[model samples]
Target: MVRESLKILLTSCFLLLFLASCTLGGGKNGKLLKSTGQPYEVVLEGDTDSIVTKILTEEVPALPQPEPLCRLIQVKKGKIHGSYLLVRTRIVVNIPAAEFSVGLSRNENASPQTVIRISARSPQQLREKLNPEKLRQLVDEAELEHLASIISTNPSKQNREMQQLVKKNFGISMNIPAEMQASKKAKNFIWISNNASSGMKNLILMKMKEVKSEKRAEEVNSEERRVKKTDAFSAQEKQQIDSMLRTNMPGETDSMYMVIPVLAKRGLWEMKGDAMGGPYVMQRIRRGKTGDEIIIIGFVYAPEMKKKILIKQLEAAISTIK
Candidate 1:
């Protein structure tokens, strides 16, 4: 367990620093500003039932995204700008040395946003969690001083080709990082079927995973129905939920905590672990979606002194998953 914590600490160090979709800059060749040669405004509105997919092709990857956690959903068209009446499911996966999130955005200033953002964070939380006293014993002020830059920076960026799609879900973009190399890219985001997992990691990912039109529509309908119910905690109970949201500094994430949609049913409260040097704390906050009878799933980890800074990074990480 102690040795595992050390590896997690190193992972936290690498991933949190690779912030995606939130950073900025692209000098030439759209190097920093990923530009795809595709048209910007997609006006097709009839039955807009289409699929979106993303695949990865890389060797010796630093981290691997969990399969089930990554998925697609078609959002209502009008919710986002210049989007077809359809949207895809959005998800983010955190792997050692990588803080990754993917999705489409609607209100973003840019159009056609099928992008990827990665970031890095402090490993202080990991060491503190693994062995607070031992960490203190093994490392002195000199080592602590070297970690200054890694903790203060955010490194989000834009993936040019899929910007249209990404913008519809994630709503924002970042400048690509100069430090990391392009691991790989897929010709089409949606290509393979459910059985695609038979191939090696990169092969499976590089070829987008496909879902049948009927099944995709069914999932979307089920999702909508889930969100259509209109009941919530009583007036007094909501006050309590509000009370929790108002407080909670959540030392490890961004300032945008507990912002559930005002009119949806079945609100979600989430906070997940940072996989620091030790077990991460669970951060929980509950709020109902104004009127949808939807079952919400969340990922919130509690706050702990060991992972003071690292928790915030992971918090920021999951916050991007909507």
Candidate 2:
């Protein structure tokens, strides 16, 4: 009896140490192992029904422009990998057996240690409990979180000269990538670009005079302006923006100019004289009533490359305007 008890105790102690090692052995450089899915993509594990699939993959129409909230949010079917197993910012949906829950956890294995998890009993329950709008919002939040991580890694990678120019002229500080160079700096305007051999990414910052209206503009005491209106996605605003681009963005000669083909969404620009074109996002930001309004434009001129990532990068940079 004594021998048997001793044997059991030894086995239990060994098992505890083994489990602890397994839990702790997986990280490097204080970062979780890199996740498996591509950037903006999620690997979904478990059985999904038509409703769940539609909810996960459907394009979000509510955005100023209709585009798949999940277009960049690619999803694949598989069990959650060990790398992203503990990631706190995750969307995890189990089958009929589990209950709904949302909480945080530390994934010792992924680059992002925190994970956001969503748990539900089943696809039907998930759909029944969450509306389409909420679903889209969750996905948007996740993507923004991922984008923020990218920005945090290199917050000051932008050119110092352009930074100074923007601060001096616009009184705004921008977070730009070091890969970009200051291309144009005019009165109350600044343009920066990464003029790579094959493709180019551009950022434009311009200040607009606010006309006095019935509602006096609120005075903002901040050094930088805040993005006030998100109405640029409207057709009328797009037309106005198109007009602005035609007048402000010049081509090499008088006959050549940039034009927006579609005013419904982020407009596409093409040089009349040249074969250059890409996608662009434009926004008008304000600093309450007393401060001037500013227009920030982020565009990509990558003809042969994928514009989604580049455009997203521009969007991320422009979003930094405080």
Model 1 lDDT tens row, 160-276: 443333333223232222222223222322111112112201100111122225643454456344322223334443444333432431226654443332312212233332332
Q: Each model's number of backbone clashes?
A: 88, 21
In candidate 1, how many Å is residue 249 off?
40
Off by over 4 Å in 1: 1-178, 189-209, 213-217, 222-322
Q: How accurate locally is residue 38 in candidate 1, as Cα lDDT from 0 to 100?
A: 18
Candidate 2, number of clashes = 21
For model 2, the run of ten residues with the poorest summed lDDT:
60-69
Query: Model 2 residue 251 lDDT?
Result: 90
TM-score per prediction, in order, is 0.17, 0.70
